[model samples]
Target: MQIRKAFRYKLMPKGEHIRKMKQFCGYARFIFNRALAYQKAQYESDNTVKFSYTRLANLLPEWKHEFE
Candidate 1:
């Protein structure tokens, strides 16, 4: 026989932590949406577009520079 237990706890972030969290979340959203938009446009322009992790990874530096 085995027993399992689960516990849930809520986070109470400090002011600075909250601000940093928001900033990180915003940045992540921007990267995610931008990648999605690029992938979508490529697919729309050419139906044979294939997803490539290497290509996407290669775009990260450009995106970071553009974001800055």
Candidate 2:
């Protein structure tokens, strides 16, 4: 007689919460960099890099409607 042990590994996030968290991160970065750009313009005098949604949408903007 022999006994076996099973092991499992997942390479990806699981469930809706994980998906939403990723999207929220995308959206949060969008909002942060956007706000940061304006702050930089007003304060930063160097050629430091900045970013925002002026490039692309990460999380869907429609999600905001959920809060409103």
Candidate 3:
């Protein structure tokens, strides 16, 4: 027999915290959109090209540096 315990806590974000959270969300959205667009473009150029997580993961640093 085994027993497990779990706890959940709600966030109480203040003004500054909310602002930072929004900024983080926006950055995440940007990264997702960029990745999707890259995949789309690659597919359009070569139909046989399948999605490659490793290739995209490798590009993350380049994307971050380019965007920043």
- For each candidate, give its TM-score against the true structure: 0.83, 0.40, 0.83
Across 1-68, the per-residue lDDT of candidate 1 in tens digits comes to: 99999999999999999999999999889888988999999999999999898988899999878867
Candidate 2 residue lDDT tens string, 1-68: 99999999976767987999899998889677765665577456656655556533543455356444
Which consecutive 10 residues in model 2 have the weakest lDDT in total?
A: 54-63
Each model's lDDT comes to: 0.92, 0.66, 0.94
Cα deviation of 20 in candidate 1 (Å)?
Answer: 0.8
Model 3 — which ten-residue stretch has the worst lDDT? 59-68
List pairs with backbone clashes in candidate 1.
none
Where model 1 places Cα greater than 4 Å from the true spot, the runs are none
Error (Å) of candidate 3 at residue 21 is 0.9
lDDT of 1: 0.92
Model 1 weakest 10-residue run by lDDT = 59-68
Candidate 1 residue-wise lDDT at 13 = 98
